[model samples]
Target: MTEHQALRIRRFSTDSAPVGERFDAWAAHSTYCDMVTTYRSDLPFDAHRDNVSIGPLILAGRTWRHPDPSLAYDAKRTPARIRADQRDFHSFSLQICGTAALRSDASTAVKRAGDLYLLDFARPFERVITPGSEISLSVPRDWLPADTGKLHGASLTRGVGSLFGDYLMSLYNTLPQLTRHDVPHIVRATTELLKASLHPELDTLAAAQTPIRDLLLQRIRRYIDDHLLQPDLTPGSICRDVGLSRAMLYRLFESAGGVMREIRQKRLYRVHQVLSSPDRPEERIRDVAWRHGFTDEKYFYRIFKAEFGHTPRETVEQVRHRRETGTN
Candidate 1:
């Protein structure tokens, strides 16, 4: 098994403060200091918590009940903050459960749950964030292969609707299962999906050419992910859907072992999820496997044990045990 680093998480809270005093301090440590937020005086200030991390890429989830805060980051503050931090990054925010509006040099848009947009931290931007929840990614400029300028201020809801959004959300969902060794691949996939979302026209050329092979591979992986639960999902089906030949598909996934290996990996992971969920303690392991496209029970049992070093039955038992014992 390949050794990977564990995801590092840092959490912050206002400590139940009824005002924005402690919030200012918490926000500083949670993210950056170039911007300021003005909380609404009409609503009672409620406590807020931010779970933040930079595990290869920045992932932050924030929850608050206060009124939409007016946020601003200007030229003077941005320059000084950039000089101080010396880091150039773009923020892609997904409004998980909220109403908000963002304005930047390129565009302005209203956003709600299921909508995602990008903001260049180095530029002058302002946003009015309503009481809600959101998950955001802070990606470094160097990490992205494509130009970030084109993505700045662009709402990615439509561009990312197909595979990009699903891939990103899947990554976020699997954070608990990821290891440090997983960071490199995750980051690379994230970068590629971002590029594809910003410029889908390049996907065709991306595969045939060497300049963006990673992006092409990410595209193929996305397609496989979207069809993972289909019983007829196969290499041929994937090639047809992605407009690639079997030879090209094989060549792309060759480095990661093979196309079948990738599909199996994704399938096994999904099965693990069903078995692990405490709420689904009564779910049958065999049924879970079949739902994820595993047709052979004996083969599924053997591979499940090999892949996770534990039997499917054992995993379900453990989940039930955890639920009964109130443990994780």
Candidate 2:
């Protein structure tokens, strides 16, 4: 409710505590607050703040930012009752960042750009990560498919083909999970993809399909269409806004062919739409094309004819004749 409201619950608080120098605990809970908390993990079990966010899912992440830090944090601890406690949630992690040593229930893995580690939140996890490294979680009991629930007992390693994995990693590296206005929808869409990616049968994943992907593609395209006049709507800007890699970004048009091809096609489509509109006859075709990111008038005509099989002049003439006869 409050702007930038922070709710922090801490097992170790140096601010009001008598001792702040070093904290040593076998295990403890964290103080959660803010859109994200960036933190440190060390023996005597230390904690730091995180800039990463937890949207809809119960996400807790840690990364090293300072020197003199070879950090390790245990999300689940070895308890006295048994080897591990029963975890109800499914957890996943991505080294969506720098380097690190990662440990799952089965073995230790190194962190890389595409490295993914899956685990059971019901069981304990120990991690030794480096600065700029990333950690993420997906609550499968609460998020994943029913049949894929079998994955919770197994250890998660990288190289799995799932959009949930990609989407989770994508959010970590690209989009800010929190926004002044858009956090809700961002969290919703992200979790949808995240849950879908966990299914053994990727077919169950709604995000990987043609329709939803196409829907998002259309949203992005329409956004581009509305903002074509902006000079800075280049690939980098589009990647940032659309939360896609420059390479994967081109795939948005793979459904049609290629990105630039789609851009030109859409531009031509808009140009024709304007030129053919009988009510907008006063608007110049050159003005319409330029408004859609066409810089050269002559080049626009060439591409238009190549695409539409007619020149801009001819298209306008056809529109004029159609308007005169009410047959357009």
C-alpha lDDT of candidate 2 relative to the true structure: 0.56
Candidate 2's residue-wise lDDT over 111-195, tens digit each? 5665665655555445444546465665647566665545543434433344555666555543332333344445566555554
Question: Distance from true position, residue 232, model 1, in Å?
Answer: 24
Top model by lDDT, which number? Answer: 1
The list of candidate 1 runs beyond 4 A from truth reads 1-5, 16-20, 33-44, 47-55, 66-77, 160-162, 202-328
Model 1 scores a C-alpha lDDT of 0.68
Candidate 2 deviant stretches above 4 angstroms: 1-61, 71-87, 97-114, 128-130, 142-158, 161-165, 174-212, 215-219, 232-237, 240-243, 268-288, 302-328
Which model scores highest in TM-score? 2
